[model samples]
Target: MPTGTISKRSVDAANPESKDWLLWDDDLPGFGLKVTPAGGKVYVFQYRLARPGQAERTPARRYTIGKHGKLTPDQARKRAKDLAALVAQGIDPRQQEIDAIAAEDEAARVAAEQARLEGELAFENVAATWLDHYENEKGRRPSSVRQAKLVVNNHLKPRLQGKPMPHISRSDLQPVIDAIPAKQRGMRRSVFAYASILFGWAHKRGDIPDNPLASMVKPQAPKARDRVLDDAELVFVWQASAKLTDPFGPFFRLLILTGQRRSEVAAINWAELDRSTATWTIPADRAKNDVAHIVPLSKPVIAELDQLALAEQIKAEEEKPDGKRWPKSGFALTTTGRTPISGITKAKNALDAAISEAREKQPLPAWRIHDLRRTLATGFQRMGVRFEVTEAVLNHVSGAKSGVAGIYQRHDWHDEKRAALESWAAHIEAIVSKKQKDSKVVPIRAAL
Candidate 1:
């Protein structure tokens, strides 16, 4: 009901809590200007919609059109006109405002995706974003994402993620990569090598300056694992394995049957096994190479798992041991209540401690749990197992040239492979039993 024009100067001077209203000289209705707590003045449009039994004395349902800074008082007047037009058509301004925001959000999302496609962000940056987006946000498997992150974080990002595509000279790359640990040198080389491919991909889209790893000296390192387990240390660990409980006993034994990483075995789930098929399937998400593998279980390995009903009883009792704090679920070494074993370190510490205690009984070679896997691999090779079977047992595809065959044409000869595993397990059992009975054992080095 207010009329005429209110000046900016008058508006600024008026008390914020003033009950009296002022009019703005504009062609549109329901438009107003106000100041925020910061004293920054802005414009807004407020209006009402009619409903059944609406009274004249009822407060006009009000909603904000825009901030004064974003929409000047004049612009707010125009928006008020639009709101009036919508109201005239039986639409509520508040509902229309919400719909507009939703549409804008959808547009913004599409724009962000298009920008990502066009930006040619560095392979390192783009990959990092993708990993963060797909792996962290969308819940892609952790192992796959971690492997990709490791490649970038350890090798690619340090040298190339920030480099302009064109400035990636081999001179800059060679020294950066030659620094990764020798054990992972081949993997290190492949990462930078992959950076070149990503850079080229970015360059084609005008995203990067150039790919730098091109024409660089490739890293030199043997990409094969050939470590063998020692004899004296073997007897000590075998003794300790029996002293542990069922699942840990079976788990510690599983490592000997399978040469996979500690993380891989610890994360073992029921879905990965099929005793009916006599095989274990490691999904690409859980595998180190990001490729699925089929392990042909031998009788002794099968027998070991069968003893625990395929690792069921131990899985059920994960986190209830004396009400101790436990890790999250899904592991080979849990005690009760679906906990991952916190004792990865504790288990290894106990291993070293046991070895220390038995040092007088046997001055064994310094060995790790991984040594058991190596010994099994070495034993199979000595037993005339094919190198392919041995490498496949370790789930490696080192010599494969064809990508399709290397990844796809995998077959698990469970029955045949079981013979080799049984032979190895029996031999270790014989060695273990012999050491248990033999009491002549003493520290080769005499105590001072």
Candidate 2:
């Protein structure tokens, strides 16, 4: 007899002292609720497979039934009946009960938090709020971001991203900074520096407590790429452009004429072009500084697009079943009318192949395709193009202005830029035959 449960006889006796006579007054030796000597009522369960006179029971388990306050008497009895059925089924009723409780706990834990969908929301509510506000919002997985993340996730985040974002300081970043190659380290530093800023941004919004980047040191930039492409290398790129068919041919030519980034040219959409005006409008979203840019399309740029338009119209007429008659590189890059090339990968393949083509012919100084822009600038400088005028042509923000004046002078610079680019385009056209030469299969050495 225990102190809690009152027997029916005790109720009939109308005496509280009779509670000691209750059947469930003590911890239940088998299953269901019980009462303790101190009068605390609790659910209890005990299970065995054999009677003492029978064969010894296999190992049995015990588990809680439920607190008396939590489970009504009738409810506890029903649970006890269920346990008895399990015991009849040759199951250790107590072990099943314990297993059930463990399973419930595990389910609750899983439901409490689900795995995060990383690509969702672009930036917020998903990616650990790790990058930028807008990028997380609008950007997709591109080469640049992919490359940058690989470094941070591999080298930095395992060490720092989970720490209090504000607690990341210069000392924490110093190890990665010092280990990077002397020439390639600036970008690595920029990644963490940007990360620190992002974490700080989160902190300011009360998402975090401190900015580790506040005291973080920026890694010094490695050697600058100052090498200018020589005239022979320049001519070789153009000549290679001539030998290549459709899109690659025209793309390299456009790159040489406009001196814009390859990605800028590759992703060009028809909406961005004003053919009549011989100009292209680059939306702020696409530009590095997020400023709108207007490029005055040179004759070569327009002429090249004109060829694409013709091919596109003709291809539309000749219509194939696959899909839209995509240009060589869709948007800005086009090969014929039917197929559109996409992504940095495809566009880069074109450039790399073209570079290999050029190398075979002339074997000029080693250089990357991006050097074309600097080469054009340097060529223009040599051609007596004014530095500021060339910079304007390049749509670069001038260093002289400060603050709101910069906002006021967003520096479209189209008019002067047009003239400057035309001058350089004329210089390039003289050497590379975008018009004079056509794609003829000639041996690289023989052509050279």
Q: Please, what is the whole-model Cα lDDT of each candidate in the order they appear?
A: 0.61, 0.61
Candidate 2 residue spans exceeding 4 A from truth: 1-11, 15-180, 201-214, 243-246, 318-330, 334-363, 400-413, 433-448
Q: What lDDT tens digits, residue by residue, belong to model 2 across residues 1-448?
A: 3343433343233323334323343433455344445565665555767645667785665556776667766576667667767776777765665798999999987654233212222223323455444245563333456544666566666555444433445676666666665667666666666566565666677654566666666676656788787765677667766766667677777788898877677667777887767778878767655556788988877777877766666766764433223243346564433333444345445555676765764345566667878887887666666665566656566653346766676544556677777766666665564443212322122211
RMSD of every candidate to native, in Å, equals 16.8, 13.3
Give TM per candidate.
0.51, 0.59
lDDT of 2 at 266: 66
lDDT of 1 by residue, 1-448 (tens): 4444434554546444334343444555666665545555555566666664654433576766666456555566667778788877668888877899999999999898556544544445675555555466443566555566677677767766554444456676676677777677767666665555555665665664555555566677554555566555666766676666555666776787666766667667655777677667888877777668777666676666555553454445754333122222344455763754446556766666666677764445555566667787776666667666667677776765237766686565444455555555656666777744323332111211
Q: How good is model 1 by TM-score?
A: 0.51
Positional deviation of 441 in candidate 2, in angstroms?
A: 31
